[model samples]
Target: IAHGEIFLTTGGRSMDRRQIWSAMKRLCQKAGVAPSKVFPHNLRHLFATAYYRVYHDIVKLADMLGHSSIETTRIYLIESGAEHQRQLERLGLVS
Candidate 1:
């Protein structure tokens, strides 16, 4: 568990789930956003969504996410619908 820090705290120690949740809640409040919309898993989903948008390769995304199946990584793609349409429009493949 070297460094034991997948997510670090302000004091440079590993952050517990509760700490991350609380911090996210606080940030959401300060931003005047719904706290329910902010969670630790959302960060992973955002990263996966951005990476997939650039690569457009699910197999590679699965590898990066250390997932045994692409289906698991697929759960992270929240922008699938609108982003797909935007890509099509950008390519002039559809009006």
Candidate 2:
């Protein structure tokens, strides 16, 4: 926010968890998305899942996420069963 400090979350402010949650809540309201459905971790997980899916490389995903171990990266690689089911159908494996 100042000359040297950096912020990972959006808006470029050094926000606490509550502030970040409140901002995301307001944004969800404006986007007509249920506030309960979105959060910073959700976005992070989505990014991890999509990145791993595209690259098909756990080590690379780990490096990108700054995880020290592949086991931690596995946590991000997991997705909702519904999403996996959709992918299965897309592959014509469920038909």
Best candidate, lDDT-wise? 1
Residue pairs with colliding backbones in model 2 are none
Best-performing candidate as measured by TM-score: 1
Per-candidate TM-score against the hidden true structure? 0.70, 0.67
**All candidates' lDDT scores?**
0.84, 0.81
Residue 46 in candidate 1 has what lDDT? 85
- Residue 89, candidate 2: Cα error in Å is 3.7
lDDT of 2 by residue, 16-89 (tens): 66776788889999999998898878877988988877889999889877899999999887778999889889
lDDT of 1 by residue, 15-79 (tens): 88899889889989999999879998887788888888898999998997789998888878755
